[model samples]
Target: MNTARLAADLVEELDEGGLRGSFLVRDLHTGREIGIDPDVLFPVASLIKVPLAAATAERIRLGELDGSAQLTVQPGRISTPGPTGLTRFRYPARIAVDDLLYLSMSISDGVAADALFGLTPPAEVNRLLRAWELHGITARHLLGALSDTPAERLPAEEGHLAHSLAISSGTSGRGHRIQQLDVARANTGSARAFVDLLQALWTTSKIDAVVQSRIRELMGTNLLRQRLAPDFTSDATTWFSKTGTLLNLRHEAGVVEHADGQAFAIAALTESRISAVHQPEAEVLMARVARVLRDHLRHG
Candidate 1:
């Protein structure tokens, strides 16, 4: 394969596929890069699972959380796509934490994700993100609502007093404005930072070595079999990936390894102005980009 030509073609194909966003493709071996914008943060969508998985695994390693504990599913866990998660259950459902994680990452299960958010409260998530040294990564407001807050009986004037105090403290109005807004954007991460995380996963550093292996296994087991995997599967090549899609946005970030153990971590994210249900346009772009990146690394 003329890998250089393919890489150039990938850029043209992205434009034709109704894509409108920034992206980055790097050669993990030689530290080469190919893309227009790698640092600009695009809505991460389900790609947020990467960090969530890391945070959860770290928690498990620290003995702060139990992975095998059973968690009861509630009705409110259901959420809309793009701004929310993928729902797999309806009615009162109960599942183990281990199963919940399997469903969340492997199946991209939204219900399972909501259950996880509840189990690992937002405060804990914030703590975990900071511990990981990841900046600009945190749960959105809706996800934050799942936190534990006790309701106390108070006079009606207490609400007014609280608002007055918040305004006095200069913290209340800022949060209120941010909350009432419904900007349907996804999560954010840079190409370089993302690859650094992937390298950490590959080397089993910055998190529990055992849990990182499990994370890799979950990525390999991802059920979204229609996109990048179809074009680039081989017995000699292994692709550990987490794919994300919502409306006109399609993203796939993973490490591709050849038979000789040479590997590269790549992330290709695209956003199209016009929305497509099956997202055939966006998928085409992703496949092209994946193929180009793989071919480039395989030969170089």
Candidate 2:
């Protein structure tokens, strides 16, 4: 199929799946790429952890922060996570920066991220990205700010009400009544922006080589795989990715390397229009769309 027809069909498929998304897949070697609205900015949710990890790694590389230095995390400092991590601890625990990076990136642990944020503020992370020549991503607040949304305030069964509010309360210009969903106010990035970061991490870039290597390793260890990982991971390939989900948003960005030395960096940032949160079909749609784009790029 032609690129135009393929893009049109992908957009229709996304809308049918109750998703409006920005997607981009670029060959790491040739730099050839394809996408749908890849430049449109969106609130990035937990995907911001990638840069957070990168910045923290940079600090450690520069000896400004000690990766081995242990920091104390008091019990109940953060909300208990859905799975398990620091928030479940009944007593104060001392963890090194290196281990915290694992929890934050690999397992999407907000408490660990907030701890790292305490060490390196959001503004510092933003400064590091800019200094490294990465653009279009803004880190404004720590991960704790994300937990304060309506989704947390509502009762268990009424959770969809928050998702309903998230769907209905949005402006044409991407503004939302919810601060976390608002691009100008929340931690945000575009599909293109994330692809650029992946490129930098996967290849030579302004980010220090040591820091980049560490960041890539953290991503390779990512445990949340139900999103795009299923489509990308294989015995013959490696998918190093990070997933972000907040309210109606779902995003994952990573580089997939094939056995024959070919690599593709892909970013899929999406928002759901459906009110109910448990949309496994939406996740499937995202993975299918992204894989189609990767297949197109690989063939042509």
Candidate 3:
């Protein structure tokens, strides 16, 4: 497989798309990174949940938290409308820690994330970030700006209270005269930092391998499935990845373990050309990289 040529081709396509910001692709097994922009910060979108899941697992390992433990979604647990907020539940739902993680990461469930955040504090999330050494560009830095006030606000669409706002409306509220918390850019991360976070998950024995496996399983629960998986699926390659999208961003990051035991970790973040719409162009960019990498290893 022509690895360098594939890498060059992907970069050429990204340049053609007019995508701004950083991108990084690394083979975890060989520790060889084959892409560019290793240290540029961009919005992480739902990709935030990947590290959040890891942080939650770390907490469980320290005996500070429990995955099987149950918690009820209360009024105070309501968050702003987003991919995973409670927009349709008639009654307070009861779920477990593992379920919350699954919902949060797999489905990008905002309600599940709020449920976890409700049980703990944003500070706790930050604590986990610090443990992972991901405190610099994490949600904790933006939580106060995004979800600072806990007034038990209702979902803007429905009558029930949902605390966090969705990306579309959240971005609109920025710099408005009204008193609203604008979180369109609530959480941000650099492409390099995100890959580093994944590196920690794949390489660190801090969290049990079994727990890491669970995290990967949940990441695969993406509903949109708009990332590298689609491009490489025809090859029968096993892909464990997570995807996040906003108005101007699309991100996917995960580890691919070949049947031959060759594993690679890749994280692609893009600010698309279309400024205000969710476009597949960013994901398409990611697919190109995935295709190049797959060919690189397949032919080699």
Give the best candidate by TM-score: 2
What TM-score does model 2 achieve against the real structure? 0.97
Could you give candidate 1's per-residue lDDT for residues 221-283 as a string of tens digits? 887767777666688788888876543446777877778877777777665544324566567
lDDT of 2 by residue, 219-263 (tens): 999999999999998999999999999989989999999999999
TM-score of each model, paired residue for residue: 0.75, 0.97, 0.74
TM-score (C-alpha) between model 3 and the true structure = 0.74
Q: Which candidate should be chosen as best, given lDDT against the real structure?
A: 2
- Position 64, candidate 1: lDDT: 79
Model 1: runs farther than 4 Å from truth?
Answer: 1-9, 76-86, 135-138, 141-186
For candidate 1, the per-residue lDDT at 175 reads 26
Model 1, position 71, has a per-residue lDDT of 76
C-alpha lDDT values of all predictions? 0.60, 0.91, 0.60
